[model samples]
Target: MDTDYDVVVAGAGPVGLTLACELRLGGVSVLVVERLAEVDTTIKAGAINTPSAEAFYRRGLLPALAAVQEENLERISGFMAQRQGGRGGPVTMPPRFAGHFAGIPLKGRLLDASDPDFTGAGPAGDIGFIPQEPLERLLGGRAAELGAEVRRGVELTGFEADDEGVTVHAGGSAIRAGWLVGCDGGRSTVRKLGGFAFPGTDPSITGHQAMVEMEGAEALGKGWNRTPTGTYAHGPFPGRILTVEFDGPPADRDAPVTAGELQASLRHVSGTDVTVTAVHTATRFTDNARQAADYRSGRVLLAGDAAHVHSPFGGQGLNLGIGDAMNLGWKLAATVRGWAPEGLLDTYTAERHPIGAWVLEWTRAQVALMRPESHAQALREVVAEFSDTVAGTTFFAKKISGVWQRYDAMAAPGDHPLVGGSAPDLELADGSRLADHLHDGRALLLDLADAPAIRAAAEGYGDRVSVVTAAAPGRPELAGLLVRPDGFTAWAADTPAPTATDALGGALARWFGTRTALPTGPRAA
Candidate 1:
């Protein structure tokens, strides 16, 4: 069957755009259709966690992220000054600002960076403050640069998928594609049309987040505050307010948020008559957590919010979606490019479903702690105390930072500690890092101790894998490593060449398929 593109991606949000870029990098054609003519400027996620940052870093996008972070830090500094009544001069983010759990601050100073999850994580291991709007724009541009076609104002109204290819109806035109992916967000049209079963807990809270001009705002306390009725936070930035009430989900979630409605919510949660005067932007949210029963069905697939969703309490939504894209992109491309092993594409759901489930439960836990009941308040106090200790702070930091995220299925039984985890940015003898070699999106086999057997194992994969011989002086125990396109360590060898060859060969075959007759052209250090 003739297809317009190898993959047709619905929605040009960060997830879709990032996937488009990845598919393009993997040498597959991708078409990204966004319903909106322009990027949405709504206030969404304020930061990207460690794993998300590291993903960007591996793709050599860290310089762009750093630029965005600098701008955000300046804006944050100004907001801090305004919060302090303009007395402080250029207030910077507190050194202890790791992140929060149930609105409880986790101090960075108390966190042990030497923990196994964190050691050798490199510079992108920290949380990066780049809001959703800019992030989408960045990824959108990157997708285009990588040769993915992005069409705006193209709504995916329907699609028909069979054993061969998918015919997608968008913007009153039917386009054919080898595969279709839904990144269209919570109310995903692709997911609905594809008959994907979504199930999860119902919401018990109605939350309001907005930026507006208001009167009597001084009556509300600054930062996160839990009252007898609910929880409210005021002013990290002037006119920025958020309130959560356990009064059931909004009657009309799609209804426009008016200043009067926000005022009432603020009054209810803050127990003060803070009058909202002029509303600039506002939205309603809920703890409506849900996950698709499966991420794929035949040629139709789902990623980002189309696959899972939960409360935005811990700022995990965008990061989680980015992860879905990173995990799905190369695998889908491999399948499209015809080198994927049997059931390689099926591993997407197997590897990512568990992570999505964990995020849902993590958000639900925060919701439980925020409940207006007296018991919840007591539980919050206990959790708060736990967060204050060194171990507790490190634990929460690992979770919030995304350092704790590892794919158990990606590892062999009794694998090295680095297996299933992001490859440490090992600096080679030539002063280059592992990430420096991954910009082209090929799998990498790093030989630290000049192992001919390990190098021979990576041969015949052609350009699918790049073998680099370099000594990583920092990690003397690591003799060799197989790093996947997404920067996960597929295989690690601390033993000698003979002992590691068979395992290396198995990993190469498992991920890159059967070895070909292509010449072994190992790149020099």
Candidate 2:
């Protein structure tokens, strides 16, 4: 088969765009095909969580993301101000926005903004509230800048994969590539065509979300409110309403969501006769959790909603999808470049599958606690007490926001603290931060001890692994650490002596591929 591209990504959403950018940065050509002619203006997920926000920050996508967030806040603030001006002279303070787990309000972030674990080594906080359209556009623009081709209005009708490569049929044409990834979303054609098994629980409830002009908006309580019928939440944006009905999914999911439907759903859930005059956009979702048995089926793979899907509770779906893109991008790039070790591509499933399972369980557990039964309310009361405590809040915050997410990696003997954990944002000697060095999308070897052996070992890989000799006095754990491109530490040694060089070499081979045992000069950055 004639291969026309290294990878043909189905879906121009955030996950596909992120994967395309990562592949392009790794020198792999990517073609992203989407069925939609324009960016989906419908608001899907509302916020980028801490971990996903940090991922965007590492790729230098945060500046534009932050700008969009600020602009949105301004727009919402102006709307609120206009509403308040005509009513009275002054009003009490509005409720502060915070993260939530299930429908339970967090009151405040679990992770502190100043915490290194939360902010990484970056200057920004762990969360951003940019709407989905701008976020998708930002990722799409970044992917194009990195030479990833995105063609809209071309849908992946079907695909065929064999030992050599995959042939994707989209827009009435065949495009061949070494790999094909479906980021097309929950009802993924690539996933179905690739024959990946997606198994999980069925939906117990239907969720309705809409942005509209409401006549009885003042009747509903501010922020999230739990009623005996169901739960409802309102946002800062005027007429943005969220409602959940315990009824199973709608009969016609593909049918256009109308203002009347939203109004009815809101009335049932909130027990208020809220009138929706106009609906800008509306959609329905369910808690039908399911994950592909394998992320890859021969040469065809899945990511984002294609790979796993759970309830949008805690806003974890978008973040999990972005995480999938980040984790698979470099590994797939390595495979395409012919430098990846055996089973390297398989590790994408091995590593991410468990996380997906955990997310499914997380949402499922939340659903159990959210039932309108008396037992569930009692359990929620106990959980609420726990959430008010520091330990409880911190645990839930890290879990929900993904700050405590860790992967299992081969640890060096006398294991370093940060191994297999999300690498911290180290403050380097030259007034720069550790995340600054990862912008080029390469494995990073930080030599805080100024170890010639470690630096020389890294030089063997050349540009594949960047060696930075910087002093991170505050972080003694940075003595010598090999950070993967996705910002996870593969190996670390506190001493960083010549004896430790052998271990570092092994980790480099394990992650960045085998290299000639040469004593080259140190690379300075």
Model 2 backbone overlap count: 1
Q: lDDT by residue for model 1 over 263-325, one digit each (tens)?
A: 999998898988998998888999999999999999999999999989998889999999999
Deviating ranges (above 4 Å) for candidate 2: 76-97, 109-116, 119-121, 124-126, 410-413, 516-523
Q: What overall lDDT, based on C-alpha atoms, would model 1 receive against the true structure?
A: 0.88
Candidate 2 lDDT score relative to the true structure: 0.81
Clash count, one per candidate: 0, 1
TM-score of each: 0.97, 0.94
Pairs in steric clash, model 1: none
On the 0 to 100 scale, the lDDT of residue 347 in model 1 is: 90
| Per-residue lDDT of model 2, residues 1-525, tens digit only | 468999999999989999999999888889999999999988698777666877787777767887998787776675566556546454333222256666777756443444445655354453367677889989888888888999999998988788999888999999989999999999999988778889888888888888899988877876778889889988667778888877677788788999888988888888887899999988888889999999988888899999998888877888898899989999999988888878888888988888889999999888877788799999998888888766676667768767777787556556666788878877878887777888889888889988777777776687478788888877766578888898888888788776678778878888888774554344555
RMSD of each: 1.4, 2.6
lDDT of each: 0.88, 0.81
TM-score of 1: 0.97
Off by over 4 Å in 1: 89-92
